[model samples]
Target: MKVVIFETDAPLPIARAKHGSYGDMFKALLQRAPSFATAGPVEYIQLHIHADKPDGDVRDFPPLEDVDAIIITGSRSNAYDTHIPWINQLTDYVKHALAEESKTRVVGICFGHQIIGRALDLQVGPNPAGWELSLTEMALTSEGETHLTTAAKEDNKLALMQFHRDIVFPPLPENVTTLAQTDVCAVQGMHRPRKLWSVQGHPEFDTEIERELLEYAAGTGMDRKIIDAAIAKLENQETRVERDRAAVADAMAAFLLE
Candidate 1:
């Protein structure tokens, strides 16, 4: 399968050294699924959206039919910020892809999730409850039970890794369905039939990378209490980090294949 990774931003220097790029982490995580063992060869194409600063443009996006799926990565930027020209460009591309008759599947993660919500005319912005970091338990809705066909099916509540402050608010698009929810965010996951699938958590993040990210956030002047909480949560054995990572990967792989 030909998969296009729409990379929104690069990892911090320290984190990148330890975990590689987000695209690299995603490739490793997706390959963990047993189905990938016999799914034949898969090709990944990384299209870095923020690489060339002043000249960046989404008009150069590849034709929809050329790839089987498109996965948009989490970004440090906010989706609701129209001041950033690239955010608008990326949102436009997503809208165009979803509106097209082609069958290309689109999966959005974190910032990507917010971007899709905005593209579909849903409210997406800062969360009133602040950032949800580390491992968080998200309860699956009836729609999730009916639509999700991977590791997420094993239980009603799945603990997945998350690191974001933005959220998709209420009054969702007419065609969208909420799949999962947490106390902090109402839209932990969502599906729009065959066109789009998105999650507010980061399936690509493992304990080690999250630890590095926490340290990075700390150095960046984030609240000390938030960073300490994330650190303590990461150290907590009850988080079951590995299991959550696998569950999200399995669900993501299944969705893309479907």
Candidate 2:
């Protein structure tokens, strides 16, 4: 399988030291999927469209037919930001990819999720409730139950490691079915049949990565209470591996393959 990794931001020092890069992290996570077992060799092509300033060019990219999937990694920048030069450009590209007929399946995480919403002309901004960080349990909607397969849920809720404040707002496009919800964020996930799938939480993030983000937030002058609480939640979670990571990976892999 040939998957294109669309990187929106670089990883922090600690995360990079362990995971190499955001693309590397996603590749590692996807490899955990059972589908990958029989899928043979996989090729991950990283594209730094935002960082490299691609200037609205697709000629340099591989033909869409060759791409099995495109996973958009989370970013530090807001999806609705007007200052970032490439934010809109990325949105435009994603919009085109989602709208046009192609073999490529698109998946978004965090900023990637919000950018997809922006592309669809839905509202994107901070959650009115507050930031949802660390290991958070999200209740799956009926649609989420059908589309998002996971055995890690208790009371029909799955725990995912998260670190984001902004969200893809409600009343999403009519074509997409909302997957999950939390008190803090209503649209925890959304799926558009075979074309796209996305989650607000970071399925690609491991314990080390989530911990690094929490500590990084602490140093960045984020609210002491928020940082401390997020750190506490991380510490309270089960050992090294998260319980739901594999389930999420398999779900994504199944969607991408479909």
Q: What are the per-residue Cα lDDT tens digits for candidate 2 across 1-258?
A: 888998877888988887888898888888788787677888889987554443333335566778877889898878898566578767776777787677677899999999889988999998887788988888999888776666544467777888888998889878898889988799998898788899999888877788888888888888988888777877746642355777788878878877
Q: Each prediction's Cα RMSD?
A: 2.4, 2.6
Cα lDDT tens digits for candidate 1, 1-258: 888888888887766887788888888888988776468899899888864462445557778778778889998878898877788988887887788687778899998999889888888889999889987878888977665444445668777778898999987777788989998899998887668998898878777777878888899999999899888887764346677677677777777776
TM-score of 2: 0.90
Model 1 ranges off by over 4 Å = 51-59, 146-155
List pairs with backbone clashes in candidate 2: none
Off by over 4 Å in 2: 49-66, 152-154, 239-241
Clashing pairs in 1: none
Clash tally for model 2: 0
TM per model?
0.90, 0.90
